[model samples]
Target: SMICMNHLKVGHYINFGLARGLGSIAYATTAFSLGLLVDKINPSLLVLFFVVGMVLLLVDLYTIEEIAINSDAKTDTHISVFKFIKTYRFYFVILLGFGITFGASAMLSTYLINIVKSLGGTTSFYGIAVFAMAASELPFMAITHTLLKHFKSEQLFVVAGIMYLVRNLLICLAPNLPILILGMLSQGASYGLFTATITYYVSDHIDRKHEMMGQTMISMMSTGLGSFMGNVMGGLLQDCFGLSIMLIAGLIMTLIGSLILVVFSLKQLKTHAS
Candidate 1:
């Protein structure tokens, strides 16, 4: 995705968001089908499925042409991680917001079974909920490029933040399975939009030479560190305090992230205007 976004000349119509949307559809299908398969068959079948998937992925990878970097360009110069961080401190702050919001949102997905049980739902409902959440991402992600025509990426981040805030808040207060499912559906605008915009955001702001680094940094922050923190903290909070307290904590973190994005984005808009 980083390589395609930064290097490939695939034309204006082909974008990271479109690719991500298609991936979401595939994920939704897999999650729903895998749950049914495991319940009806032996769990060990998962290994076979994974092996097949790996083989298919390898075949797909083999078809991709390697992007050549120009040696004469400054793209060859190696920038230290510390140097990259120092130079792009402001962007790093935005990335911090991404990390926090993504973590909070991810906590819900990680502990979704617990949430379903609390609402008197079965494991089947959990599978359905997962399908709903992932499938909902597709439409919003598909139209992200269209949205970009009218709004800046920073502005869309704010919108996505608001969606996260609403989604978490709904989950926190939901009293029934239907309401919970509705909250899950809100992922279309939150995670879906955020994921679609992030690569473009980093590519636009960072230098070409550091584009891959920027993408990696965002992935590390959001998927790696952020997800780890969310899972650990959410579990601790749920065990010690209760599910409600943990959810409220997630909401607060999301709010902070949204505010950070809003404040910094406004500053960026002002700077650009001036």
Candidate 2:
């Protein structure tokens, strides 16, 4: 559906805008739902959120109407859920990426509030932190859109690595509100820049027909997989490693991601030129 809009000759701009808007709305809706569940349920906040997430998964599976890619009503009518997924290596890349990014993110997010309180933060401070973190995304997003015109996935990936490292490094050094806020601001760059660049990269690399699936896969990683991991691990790490250790671990993972990107970018360029 997303790719179909991407390839349209006319109405392209309108279609793309609507598709992105709907995606944003879906995200906003989910965030709102989670907030409401936590606020109203209070004592069973965790259970409420778990059930809500499950409900969302059910909706995704059964609610969204799907049309076969190349439907031939007479004979080419057989298809399975896994059919499209089984055919592409890029699909798996997206899945793995989603796993690493999302899982790690969940662990981090889960601990972030607690960690702040441990470091002398108040409830209002947590709210301030969340707002600051979100506010930082806009500038980085604007920067990405501008740079993407001249750079490629490879460069953006490298920069994202550096940003993540910087954020984690700052956390390890200064576990205070201001520095933490700075680290989170760096997170906006890591999240927005990496995602935007990688999506465009996948769109460019994957076969035209599967671009939308690739896009969806990326979204699933950052939101579904990332959120899950961030919450789970975030709590665990806060209990186990403490804030410093979490920062070190996150820094290492991001560094590894950066190195992999660098190697891949060089290889890709050489392959393309030859």
The candidate that wins on lDDT is 1
Question: What would the per-residue lDDT of candidate 1 be over residues 145-247, giving only the tens digit for each residue?
Answer: 7888899887887788788888887887789999999999999998899888877777677887787788889888899878998999999999999988888
Please give, for residues 1-274, the per-residue lDDT of candidate 2 as tens digits: 3543344422333333234334534554555556666777674777866788799889876964453344224544333326656766443543454356445444555566765777799766666666555555555654554586787666676667566567655654555778877876776666656665665566556665556666676767667765766666656775887776675665565555555545555565567679
Which residue pairs show collisions in model 1? none
Q: Give candidate 1 misplaced runs (Cα > 4 Å).
A: 10-13, 69-72
lDDT of each: 0.83, 0.58
Best by TM-score: 1
**TM-score against truth, every candidate:** 0.93, 0.65
